[model samples]
Target: MATIQSQHKWRFFRSGGFDQVALDSAADLQHLSELDPKLWTVLNCPTTGLEFDCRTLALLDLDGDGQIRVPEILAAVRWSCERVLDAEIMFKAPGLPLSAIDDQDAEGANLKAAALRVLEITGKTEADPLQVTDLADMTLLFSPHHFNGDGVVMAELTSDTELAQLITEIIQTQGGQLDRSGGLGIHGDSLNAFYQQAAAVVDWHAAADPADPLFCPLGDKTVEAVAAFEAVKAKVDDFFVRCQLAAFDNRAAEALNPAVAVYDVLSNKAISSSDKDVAALPLAAIAAGQSLPLGEGINPAWASAMSQFKLLVVDPLVGSKSKSKAGHLTADQWQQICDQLEPWRSWQAAKPDTTLHQLELERLQAIVAGDGKERLEALIAQDLAASTFADNVDAVERLVRYQRDLVTLLRNFVSLSDFYQRKHKAIFQIGTLYLDQRSCELVLKVSDMARHATMAPFSGCYLVYCTCERQGETPLQIVAALTAGDVDELMVPGRNGVFYDSQGRDWRAMVTKVVAQPVSIGQAFWSPYKRVAAFIETQLQKFAASRDKDIEAKTTTGVTAAATPASTPAATAAVAGFDIAKFAGIFAALGLAVGAIGTALAAMIAGLFSLVWWQIPLVMAAVLLLISGPSMLMAFLTLRRRNLGPLLDANGWAVNTRAKINVPFGAALTGLARLPAGAKRSVADPFAEKKRPWGSLLILLLVAVAAAVFWWFKLN
Candidate 1:
């Protein structure tokens, strides 16, 4: 029988010492021969669908880059995946036993090998995602790390070393160590039940009991806790005082992520279960077949605080915890919940070097019985029996030893995962900080290029206006100069734009909203809205100065005096603060107004040339309003929805914003009337252009009235 010859190729496979060794060109293609000869024949055989061999390697090396990147080798790899790899490297492997080749066992082996293979490919050398247990841990320890927004913890407090230390101490002091991995139960034993027991044990110290004197010594600890808490507060005060900018360094979040992730992973059941499958299985299948819900089960309020949170809802209509929808909290509610959850997440984010993938190894081992090494050895011995020399002890030993090498692999897998989780957090944080700081810095640098924000140029300014928007449904806003352009863009809803540079990042706000036409600072004082009215007042004051001081004073006094009547509750109630009765009342009044307007419009149309268009609601509304008297109920109702901001501000509170409303056109006027003194101009009138079609209403009313009049006229 002729021995099948190996071919030359260029490839980098890791040596035992963890060094890259070039093989294909320098040596021979033994990677294939390492499997069974029959399987190899079937793969490369003419009759089989799988094709290509050494020539395939040549095709990969044709490029000047001189290395076979992932894309270049895909064709051969894809063919290999279909049947070749399984035939040779797997089922026909020289050392594998016939019994182990049975469908069930082979299935398990295939699954495990797939898991291991995934790690070999696609994973980055610098920081492997699969290697890291808690990517945040590695991220925090690495350099160029910066603080991003925050985690579940009070970032402002946690960023302070003193507060962090105090928190660490407080948790340690309060939280008795839980033996998370200590006990294992067989059969139907519930882990959640065990956790509950553990919880009880931990809280036992906090419970008040006459027989239990744990509370006797609580006095001393309270004082100490107070002192520690105070000390932490002091440090926070100093950090705030020392901060030169709006927020802490961006990398600060990166540093915290590791700790946060640790707690999160440890507390998270889904992530841990996903990690369990990693140790026993091969990388490829483990990764491809399953995805981890890491930190997914975090407390909703706390999870909401976490930026990574994704809301999942089951049948929200039905009552099921897991089936709940994402709950959107108000800004205040969001802040309140986030404040509570941040600390818990911060504590969880810090554990382990291995990632969810690596942790799965332990989990798989625990489930299948025995550790990773035991599983690998059993697999190797079982497969070696499939060889033609299945009865030979020597071959069996060699195969067993070969498969045992998996221990080294398993160890490295754990370490690498550990590194990634740690570093990922730090890197993410740093990236965040860099973006925020750089955005502001870039804008400052570009001011000269920006043409000195006059009203015209300012109106076009879409960037630098993205603030915490009242609603995500709306676009980012800006105080634009109407003089810059037509100001049409400012009036439309969602007329917002984001600015991006050559690189897509830190998109600055570029929203535009025209509040007023240009005016002097003096004229604004006599105007209703300050910024616009003040500028007018400023210019008019200069002109009026030569004319008469008394007239100027009178104008200013008239403006000031006009404001007093508006301060009353009646005016406040005139806004959209209307109740059920009021809402209906306003609609009724509006209905009558439109009826009158429609009548007048129809009359004008009739008078125009004997051809009438009675569809006009405006003229009908005017006519109806004139015929029907006032609706005191609607007037009373409109007063209830008076703007919340003005209500709060008038009681010695500064609204402290140039906020606008998202009320519809007609509602915009009502909204504007309700605006607090601190409310920004460009405040929309509730009833701006949002007029619904009156044709339908006109038809309905006209049809009823015309029929009645016609019947009466016919009878006469």
Candidate 2:
């Protein structure tokens, strides 16, 4: 890959500890494709979650894969530069001028024509340079009723009432697609699907002609007859099966019929004919070779259903034919009714499954038989004819955006000079987080804290992940880099702050997590001493609490003893008495402890006095180094190695450069608080504590002890 080269001469600048090619002119961007991909700061970046214009990013992301890669950027740059006559005009201006468009090439000419058409439609024919906002006003270019080459025809596209109502019915039944004009309409696929379902429904209804005895069974009344048949079919079949079983074995009849105990249970409570247990009994008494008595001997629970069945089904097939008695249906007659309705059952089962069935059959037939489908097809074709115009308008939009945003993107992607020079916030920097008495500008939007934290530790910079929220909006997480301030107050997880986005929208932010690293060398220098002080304070608090508990227990014991009736003066005196021997022993131990500490102090003071003043300073310096040296050195190494790559990579960018944020650069990213210039200061305070002489007396005593030690050393 190194052997491969471009003829273009590239100029480079040093930043982030690496060389980045300069994209300062149109020629540089025109030749960007020939440049080495290895030198680009970012190979690709997500089209979302950035401070840059997302609309422009979407235009650059040709594949629509949510990432804008080097090839896509190169293609966009090449296309935009070619369409312009003087590519240098892109950097100098914010909009694309009509005269600047190169009309020599066919593509460029088409784009210019489209731009003119857009201007004509918008009444901006005199607009020298077409702005991005002009193209964004879609209402001016296409109305809800106009065809904009999206292949969708809205109901208002036709003035014919029948056609419009047909389109509305198609949309209501089929759930139409939304068109570019913001109206719900149908494209070819949806329109074809709707009519096809309509045709199927018509064919299904036609197959059930009332004149066909095979399907309708009872001319003009088949549906009602079939419904009645279904209602009583199961009970009638059960009754016949029980009769067949009784003929097979006589004893089965007595067992299959309702037992006397069932009536005994019903006798204990008020019962209705429609009661569930009563309906649950056999439809009629089971008997061998018995015709089902439809009228008088029938189970009261099933009487209503049997009447409808007799009128609709049994009467039509058997009573009308005079083949059976009026009151009963034999087993053979029931079989004949089931056999005659089978064709209709099969026909009904084949009905189409679609929401189009909601339309009346006649309406469906009229729609299928009319020219609505052909008209819709023609309308879609007409809409599709404007596709080229629509695409050209988009090209105009892209041209305008590229003229405005191409150079900025090149700076952020190819070089990152904007970030390094501190002239602009990088695209990945979402907003500034004001926290811990400091304003951190290098804040990035975070989607998932757990996922970000996994790779963020490698950045070697102190980061705080906060959940920011506003009322009536969703909560989002952001990670802010704390580079300049002391970390003493920043490591608290529940700390609150305010974040201002690039648009100046304020959100309440609360720190939910802290990824600790060296914020600054000064903070590291005091960390060890602070830890020691904290440990001492914690121990003192524990000791005080224990002592208080012990004293309280003793006081309670004394009060109890005083209230006791059996407590004598002798007992009280024994408890209160202190042994003189024990007192004397404790005093001796205290004296020995004091003597040992004083001896150690005297030795240190005499040794210091014996040394020369210069040597004493050196000794003190060495002691300080022993305490704070390792911490500062470690902090320095970490601060130097802080790279912005991992932070961006965790957010879905393929950052190709190290993008180091060394100590000085890091400090610029985070701004510590300071008073305004010329601010006044005063020493007097009404709430200040009273003046004290103990500090001065302690200093005087220390000087006197040093003088006495020097005198004694001279005498020796």
Candidate 3:
């Protein structure tokens, strides 16, 4: 997402996530907007009333009741103890639930402080939820390769000069005999050519001489040859026709195979095509995920489980000292961690399955080495060997079962791990994105160029994604582009991109260019969190229900499953010592905080009315159109690009469920309005960038008073 940062810049700097409710902490006249510096000064703001839950960030009224305040201008004046450094992190991953990181800074400018920052910047806003479905989970997302393999060479290879010198010395001492035997095997193009020649010799077979000159060359009959050619042509036509008919017969045979029934089961209408979403694309599961077929990496059970939990991320968890706006974790540390996990996978692959005997089935797993890999390699080294023709022509009865079993096991391990790694890469962002729920499928599907990989500061590409961790009706795709500065371009979907869905389908996306700008890490991880959270919530609910049933069964009939998560408690605390009065006071204080600002706003309104004339509808239709016509047009264009009609259709489970996710301004604003409140539960504040000016707003208020005074004097 290096290129997706533009929207973040445009959002924080220009649009400022503006909304009406959070703008006027000190209540302003309705229908008016502005960035009031005074609003920044007083703690009391009626419009951006503080909510206890803190997910809702209040909107800052920067321009005295007309325009939103610029974040930079606010930061320049008074420090609002909100922004994390100067960057916006809270807005990126508000629900990350990172408590340890938050305690680092009291002023809340540290990386963890960003959650509060996003709110302080936005102030607060009241909103009617948009007429959209499943938007609460609107967050950024993407999949990148994160499950890294260990280094091949633990120690660096010797340099050419060192190798050459050693080789020369060896040759001088042993007259090159050592070099011929051990220094280097027959290799390079020369070795390849030798093998080719040997293979050619082994495969060479002389065809019987069809000409038969030994018996009949003296005949030399041209007229007879022409007649023979005509006969051959007729025979060739008949053969061609027979071959076509055979092709048709073969097709029929394949269709009738049991394999065809298996394919039908795989594509059964009962499974993916459910009544909940009949209009969804028949290939929705394909759209959800794609990797090697089953029997490659994991068992069918594991594959199905994984399909439910794949992800696609673009950046790495380890932050390099590269030119990135978001300060990421140390790359070397993350690499070390990546190295540590290698043995776990290797151990799983090298499970001693084949070694155990059937007699030990109750006590042990088999770990037998089938056909040794070394044996296969030895055969492959022979000149006569081609994978296509490695046949035991003498019918020596090769042990095919052992070799196949190991190969099959290795393949299954590789495919599942690779797919899981891809999924982890897509959604498991490093900075934030705490485990909203621990046990659910997180599938990541991304499409890139065929068999292509790109190197980053590390050996391979790493992708980090952040999304708005909100609830939604459907799954979404989030991406983030990293850069050193504020970006302004919008990033859209591109070709061979990855997407993860709710039902465990992770598929690569087929798209063209996705124009995007840099997005902060916080903005990238929100969607996955939302999905995981939803799944976890559901799981918890289901678990609770099951527990109730189990308890009932145990009490009534004394029957239960052998497995159990239920456990007895050691002790219980008495509730008699609880202080109700103190808790009530705390609640009262919270209520006062919300209402205090409204009073101040009422006073300000009274004062303003003493100076103003009347509601002349001076903001006439023409003037209103002039002020917002272009903006309205832009909004309209954005709606069309978002394609909510198609989205709504999909949500409705009507026809054509291939809906698009276009992050619209309204949707963003809604996310923004809820930002401050959302930040309270997450790791850090995401929106508090630079604070608005207190003096600027006070100055304006004083100036307005002076103007009203002057008007009264002139009338007198």
Candidate 4:
């Protein structure tokens, strides 16, 4: 095969201990496409941030598994090269119009049609070349607000009066021309300014008339009344204190003059009554003689004195006479006073009722009434025009994004082509590693490795190593897999054997490092069963060893006792005298155990026999499936997903392809033990014994007899 050569002199670069070529031109990309598919730098890669035409990649991923293989990439490049005017044209221009595309090819025709449709949607002339601006415009024109179910430019105001008022407010609040194009559109910066200005206008109007319309007369009256009641309460308390003192002392009332007496007591008649009571009481008793009592309802003289004083003083001072009369405040009287003062208490307590809404409505009405309406209308018109232009600009911006994405795709593919052309011998540019301990595999391309060399490698895969210890006499081996990264600094050969992954996560690993090949599913499938068998064999050997030791101990004791000649006779007799009952009991117990197991087996067989003939086979099949179905299914699935991606990803390579290692391919990747060429081994073993055919013949005869009996029973 003729090796492909690059038309342009490729610039060389070093990354991750490998030589790399810079893909700077379309010719470099074309030369790469001509090289062997294996020589391509990457097979499968995540398209997340890398620019590549999604449609092209989709075409390249033949299996639709979101990965593009070398063959797929090569095929796509070849197809495009054959059809397009120049594959490089994609990278040269920001975009091309539908007319620029060749209509001869199906792909070009479809793309052209799509571009034309985009132009139409954006309200651009059909002849106009499709650009990033056109795509952006289309997106904006179809946005929620502009293309809502309702007709374009829906009325912001429902009523003519409201519209006129809004216009007037806008004119007065924002006197300058509505420069929507200059950042005054709905989503523009000027809208914020507009709001601030509107708020200022409202504040000015409110300041001019500070009286709140929602303010209630009752609220003010309630406050005033509460203050008045507080003032009166102090005076009443002083009067009460003086009266109480006077009642206790006869000379206490003499201190109060006629002017002070009227203020203290509501009536002059109360004073006369008090004087009569004082005269009736003995002067010595009134002077608080030790035998005289002053308690109410207890002493007649004291009671008569208190009763007259209260009727003439306390009743007229604090007691309520009628609903209209207020001598002093009582609980009911106080409540009545509050109620009269504030009737809107309940309304006030429910929820706050601010007058801002009413104020705003008034401001709007005022703005609409004057000559400001015409100016406001003009401003609205200007704003609408600016909004239309802004929407177009947004569309253009979005279209530019699409262009950038396409440019990125072109750049990546072109670069890949250059790399391939320069490195023809790198057939396995993407390498695969298998880790038996981790049961993980990785397939890494050159680019993925370079990226991984960075401080923060991608998280998809990691390299890890650990020490594996065998439970028995086998020496420990260091095993590694695509499972750990540099972040796992604490990981060591022994200890917890923990390692960190590329994602900076820790994991306990049994492997030291990833290998070039891993154990296949066939080998893995029987590993557990083999381990169980080995364990059982070891246990049985240990049990046999223990039983032999016990027997040896007993023999040694018998020999030791026999060495004493005196006990020899008794020991021999004891050995010779076999206990028939004990023997019979031992046999009986053994028979019972055998019978129990046989009975259970018989019962199970009988149950199977009771089923219909066809059902018996099905039941047996179901039993077999129940035993091995999960194991087989798991093995099959594991085998299918056993790809080289994870292993490569761990090593910091971005595998863009499935790179599946099926059974046959897996076998090739990992070799099994085999005899060397021209090697010979002895067929005979020194311990081998001759076998007789009688036992086998007898077993076959018994099986035949059993089959005959079963057939006879079924016929009967």
Give the residue spans of candidate 4 off by over 4 A: 1-536, 565-585, 604-620, 649-659, 672-691, 708-716
lDDT of 2 by residue, 1-716 (tens): 34347888899989888898878887887788888888889988888888888899988988889998888888888888888888898788687778888989788888889899887877776556798988886656777677789898998898989989998998898898978777788888888889889989998888777787787779888889999999988988999999999999999999989889999999999988899998998888899988888798888999999999888888878895443565878898888888999998888889899999888888998998899899889989999997877888889999998998889998988889888988888888899999878899899998756778898889998999999998887998999988887787556989899999888999999999988899888888898899899899999999999999999999998888777754678887887788999999999999999999999998988898899988999988888788999999999999889999999988988899788998888889989888889999787999999889999999999999889988998799
TM-score: which candidate is best? Answer: 2
Alpha-carbon local distance difference test for all models: 0.30, 0.87, 0.28, 0.44
In candidate 2, clashing pairs total 0
Residue-level lDDT for 548 in candidate 2? 100
Candidate 2 wrong stretches, greater than 4 Å: 1-9, 137-139, 143-147, 155-169, 212-217, 242-282, 285-303, 315-317, 320-328, 355-376, 557-589, 681-683
Q: Is candidate 2 or 3 superior in lDDT?
A: 2
Across 290-382, the per-residue lDDT of candidate 4 in tens digits comes to 211113212232345344433433343334545223222233443444444343333334322332234365664464344443543444455
lDDT of 3: 0.28
Rank order (by TM-score, best first): 2, 4, 3, 1
Better-scoring candidate (lDDT), 2 or 4: 2
Cα RMSD for candidates in order? 36.5, 3.4, 39.1, 22.7
Model 4 worst lDDT window (10 residues): 285-294
Question: lDDT tens string, model 3, 1-716?
Answer: 01222221111111112111222111211111233332221111221111111111121333344222334223312222222132222212222222322244543323333333322323422221111111122111100111001111100122334333423332232232211112322212332332333333222211222244432221343223323323333322332343344455655433322344555655666544233333221211111112212123322323332232111100221223341113221224323323533333333344333211222332111111222223222322432232111121100011111111211211111111211222222111111111111111221121222211121111111122323222443333332222212122222323233434433344443333232321232233243445467899999999999999998977654333224333433211221136889999999998898789866765554555454465424434556566555545543443333321221121111111111223332232111212444565654667767667997999999889766665665565
What tens digits encode model 1's per-residue C-alpha lDDT throughout 226-312?
233333233222323323122345444334222445556557555432354322222111111122121353223222222222221
Clashes of 3: 149
TM-score of 1: 0.15
Q: Which pairs clash inside model 2?
A: none
Weakest 10 consecutive residues of candidate 2 by summed lDDT: 320-329
Candidate closest to the true structure, highest lDDT: 2
